[model samples]
Target: MKYINKKIIFTFLLVLLMNGCLGIIPNKDSVTRKDTTTNIESSIYKKYNRHTDTTYYSHNNLFGKNISIYWTKKKKEKSYARIKFSYLGSRWIFFNEVTLVNAAGSRISFHIKSTDISTNVVSDRIVSEKANFLLSKVDIISLKKLFNSPSVDLRLSGKSHKDYALSESEIKSLFEILSYNP
Candidate 1:
């Protein structure tokens, strides 16, 4: 009987691993400063088993500031690219000052019509912008040559004074993070 119970437990663990039932949940805290994840939405993370590999890149024009970016997929129907900007001195992601150009040569502007914003002070007030603009697939054939190469120049242009671009490594990491199925 004891042997049978042990086997059952092993089987259960295997199933959980295979189905991705064991994953860190994505939440506001997941992308926040390097501490205090108390505000995380554990229920959603428990339900979906999201992979919590967040990518960080330094912000342009903001000294000593880095932006945290992460990807999330809900019910396999909605995919999101969340970008958070914060600084200790004085800098924030002004909605009108940011623009994103995808690999398809499409220039998309940030829409402030409706979004969920939460304020908490850990390192600084993080301005999070979760957009579904990256939900669909894009033509990455043009990026094959630039794969994992951090020699390309990417600049952000719009109504914002800040400046930053995805390094080659960052672009590769972005692709890897978004390649998730769930």
Candidate 2:
């Protein structure tokens, strides 16, 4: 009888020790360490993906409207264009700019220097040599109007051209979508 009691007691103690080691009871104060290095690395990679090769713009009081835009190379032989209405100046004139991206991963930027209604100037210049075109006088006004219009489209010109043109409305819509998803 004594042997039977000892055997039962030994089994109970073993079960109890196994349950404790297995965390059957929640340890509220236990310092459970997690290896977050992988998660941190993934998050860092995701940040770059989030803003990869994209241009962003916001309200420019000079343009009298709010706008956003984005563009990327559409094909090996083609470039991308984006335009956005930044703001309307005090004179109720719209301000905006156009951004171009070529298949070679270059950005071409242009903006309005002056408008008929206001002296407020909105200007943009390519920060990199990857951009291979210059903004002409007519191109500036045309780009601004494009963004001002309700519809958006891209029209490419020039032989061996790296220049791209976009309207204001199109730019804004693209940025709006990007901002929403981001």
Candidate 3:
């Protein structure tokens, strides 16, 4: 009978100790992860993956160099273009000049801009080059001119950079989908 009483006391104390410890332990799921990869000054890690189900565009022998592009809208609610390219010992913009020409002969140039997105890099290779070029709603509406024109052209050119062109067919195929993905 005495042995049974001691066992009961020990069990009660153990249970009480465990309950106290539970309150002191931190819960990982309750904590949110801070985003540090995005928003860097003059760094490749500034590009982050903002899109889901990315679509790729590439052409061989585009001015004697391989030119490629990946675009989508997922993480970034803003209208942006991320270019993963190699030119002039740089891993950012592949072309020095980019323009959109409408049938009315209106030529709109795209100025490369910095973004808060981040891309991981290791050693000397860019693992991910996700540069975000924000496109505002007003800007997209203006693009309607190029889309509705009889002939739309996406002309890209640069020194040491790959010069490439996207036909009307290519622009139409991606514009509607990439521009509006809610």
Q: How does model 1 fare in lDDT?
A: 0.36
For each candidate, what is the lDDT? 0.36, 0.32, 0.39
**What digit string (tens of lDDT, one per residue) describes model 3 on residues 1-182?**
99988877765554444323222332233211122122211111123343544332221111112222233443435334333332222244434455667668887676554353344552243232233354555655566445555466554443333343444433432343223323
Number of backbone clashes in candidate 2:
22
Better of 1 and 2 by TM-score: 1
Report RMSD (Å) for each prediction in the order shown. Answer: 17.8, 27.9, 22.8
Ranking by TM-score: 3, 1, 2
Per-prediction count of colliding residue pairs? 1, 22, 12
Q: Give residue 154's error in model 2 in angstroms.
A: 2.1
User: Considering every candidate listed, which one attains the maximal lDDT?
Assistant: 3
TM-score of each: 0.35, 0.19, 0.38
Q: Compared with the true structure, what per-residue lDDT tens digits does model 2 show for residues 32-68?
A: 1122222222111111233454433222211222233
Better of 1 and 3 by lDDT: 3
Model 2, C-alpha of 54: deviation from truth (Å): 21
